[model samples]
Target: MCAAGLAWEPLLRLCLSASLVGCQNSKSFEPPS
Candidate 1:
């Protein structure tokens, strides 16, 4: 459905950005350095 696809576009973007940030944070994480 076009409407459902449109509605999910922003949600998908948000999820992608969130996961990207999480990935970056995890990659360079130095817990006690």
Candidate 2:
């Protein structure tokens, strides 16, 4: 369980970072009203 938690933690962080970056890119690319 400890080893699994360690492995999953970094993956979860990477996924969160990726989603955050994607959200920032989409917001930046959106056209102004």
Candidate 3:
């Protein structure tokens, strides 16, 4: 459990950052849809 949590934490942070960056990119640059 301890090792799993440690591994999960970084993955979670990476996913969160990716989501945040995607949001920012969408806001900053409009894509043709």
Candidate 4:
């Protein structure tokens, strides 16, 4: 469990960063459809 918890930290950080990038990209584009 200890090793797994440590492994999860980076993955979680990557996912959060990806979502943030997605949000920023969407905000930059004009609304459509």
Expressed as tens digits, the lDDT of each residue in 1-33 for candidate 4 is 999999899999999999999999988895876
TM-score of 4: 0.70
In model 4, where is the ten-residue run with the lowest total lDDT? 24-33
Report the lDDT of model 3 for residue 27: 87
Quote the positional error of residue 15 for candidate 1 in Å. 0.4
TM-score, each model? 0.63, 0.79, 0.69, 0.70
What TM-score does model 3 achieve against the real structure?
0.69
Candidate 4 segments whose C-alpha is farther than 4 A from its true place: 1-3, 31-33
The candidate with the higher TM-score, 1 or 4, is 4
Q: Kindly indicate the candidate among 2 and 3 with the higher lDDT.
A: 2
Query: Which pairs, if any, clash in model 4?
Result: none
Q: Kindly give the number of clashing pairs for every candidate.
A: 0, 0, 0, 0
For each candidate, what is the lDDT?
0.92, 0.97, 0.94, 0.93
Report the lDDT tens digits of candidate 2 across residue range 1-33: 999988998999999999999999999999998
Candidate 3: RMSD over Cα atoms?
A: 2.9
> How many clashing residue pairs are found in candidate 3?
0
Candidate ordering by TM-score (highest first): 2, 4, 3, 1
Model 1 over residues 1-32: C-alpha lDDT tens digits? 99998989899999999999999999889586
* Candidate 1: segments with Cα more than 4 A from true spot: 1-4, 30-33
Candidate 1, residue 18: the lDDT equals 100
